[model samples]
Target: MSTQSERIKERRKELGLTQQQVADPVGVSRVSITQWENDPSVRISGANLARLAKVLKVSTNYILNGGPSRMEEPSGQYHLENNLAAAPAMHGQVPVISWVQAGAFTEVCHVELDPEDTIWLPRPPGASEDCFALRVVGDSMVPRYNPGTLIFVDPEVQPENGDDVVARLTDSSIEEATFKRLILEPGAPKTLMAINPNWPHRFIEINGNCEIIGTVIADMNLRRR
Candidate 1:
């Protein structure tokens, strides 16, 4: 008898779907699909199981039992997975705010100012629902991060030495936020450094005038056509 893992792998291949393609609509990492296909003992949660069923065009009972023979389907109606109403719920939503609005966003934390511009993202482990995203605006961090790159920020993550971070100038006179690599050494003052050496203002001393807003966890680059 075929195991659940074998059934999942066979069905996925039969439908010509890659693991990443399935993971995207389901709001999970591709690693999750790999594990599910290799380990029969790995239990998929109810929500993800339902999502897998829909994407695979099979019934949850067939997935759990390893074949259609284990469970009978109704005479006229199709499987529940075929119904649009049965789609899996989104993992979470991250607000994509402008660079100028980033400063005030970190201050308020959870307030939803605009909903239409938000992006759905799979919540990372230990990341809070308050996490947000920002689009790179300048070439300050060129070579590593280019303009129009989308970066996800987690305010709860502790900014460590050499970590990329979004910082705000605490000087009330400057309302703009900046993105750079943070440098923190024992007994030495903190500073922000840009990746591009050609940028005029490369180093910024974070004396009492700057505040670290959040640590950058992940980024996506959308190539222009």
Candidate 2:
């Protein structure tokens, strides 16, 4: 049986991809990929391994265990088909911005918030081309959106009551953006709510000092096992 390192090197060579090509998509340097391929015991993070598996078009189980090559003609085609069927229908890439960056992002009216830091994600059905993404910060929306969740926001969508949204406080000095449920009623005050019940001060009334940035259309949780 081949070692895990050998499997990674062999599969990469079979796919005609350079170490840098494999590294770029997984957010690592070429040297890191070289280390991973040269040292069997060097541990690769689960998140990076998953990204690498997706880019290499192989299973994580096969990558880690060095099982029978899925590249064998019969199994290769089947594996390729399965990958295609299971893959996300990627419409385009979206920038994954931080809370501080998100505030700056709202100030600039552009489709690409930060082109250099973006991820390819499936576009929501009927979503316009102006959608962007934000990485959840804090435990405010716990069950619905844990920290590190990637949420796709559509500025074109008209936000309704009870819709999840990204909002910015009107004060330009405040750099952090807020992610919460938007509550709008006919006569009551508009408010933002934290979905997590245990969080102290779970609600903030939206007065004239806030602006709705966008409505969250879809989300992708990247937590690794």
Candidate 3:
């Protein structure tokens, strides 16, 4: 019988899904998956471990006990080994890395974070490393984050019932990123709404098509308090 990790790797390949594909569904990373299969030092949450078991066509007990089992268990649907990583922020200030593509798969480009892009007020320590800062180049996200202002994106933060979020609209031609309010329609369709009365409240229908970069932890330069 295949070992626990071996079984996971085998099942993943059988599904024809990339490491990333599997990782997203399970809220992890492809890199982590690779490490999990190779290192015993890695561990996953019980919930995630169960999900993995389901994907691998194995019982949770099978993984925990590694008891007598068949090596050729059936395969199923697709699957962060991050153990020692820490936040990269500074004292009295947060170090915003740079905005990353939380939605579409665009060409990877490097960004040299500009000091002006950061704001040092009412933010958690090491919060800078939690998000990427993007310069607002247009008015799509006006009345909140204006042009030339910097918005921070934390992909790990979940957008709340109606919190503003950094999202990637399905239409690539639109602004590279937009900050919008999340609107969950339950039975209807998931979408984002623009509250700026000047601009139409755009509804970005979400399904398997759209991507959410992250929730906006803090807004920059809306107005002076």
Tens-digit lDDT track of model 3 for 16-84 = 766665555344456778887777656654334544554455555565457755245434543223452
Q: Rank order by lDDT, top first?
A: 1, 2, 3
The digit string of per-residue lDDT tens for model 1 on 46-72 reads 445655666676766677786453333
Q: Give the local distance difference test score of model 3.
A: 0.55
lDDT digits (tens) for residues 1-225 of candidate 2: 888899899888877788866766565678888998999998764445656776676766678786653422333322233233222323423455567766655565443222223455555676655666777878989988888888998878999999999889885576788888998889989999899999888988978888888899998877571
Total colliding residue pairs, candidate 3: 8
Candidate 2's TM-score = 0.56
Clashing pairs in 2: none
RMSD of 1: 12.2
| Model 3 ranges off by over 4 Å | 1-123, 126-128, 170-175, 222-225
TM-score between candidate 3 and the true structure? 0.44
Candidates sorted on TM-score, descending:
1, 2, 3
CA RMSD for every model?
12.2, 13.7, 14.9
**TM-scores across all candidates?**
0.57, 0.56, 0.44
Error of 2 at 120 (Å): 3.2
True lDDT of residue 146, candidate 3: 70
Which numbered prediction scores highest in TM-score against the true structure? 1
Superposed model 1: Cα runs more than 4 Å off: 1-91, 223-225
Ten-residue stretch with the least lDDT total in model 3? 84-93
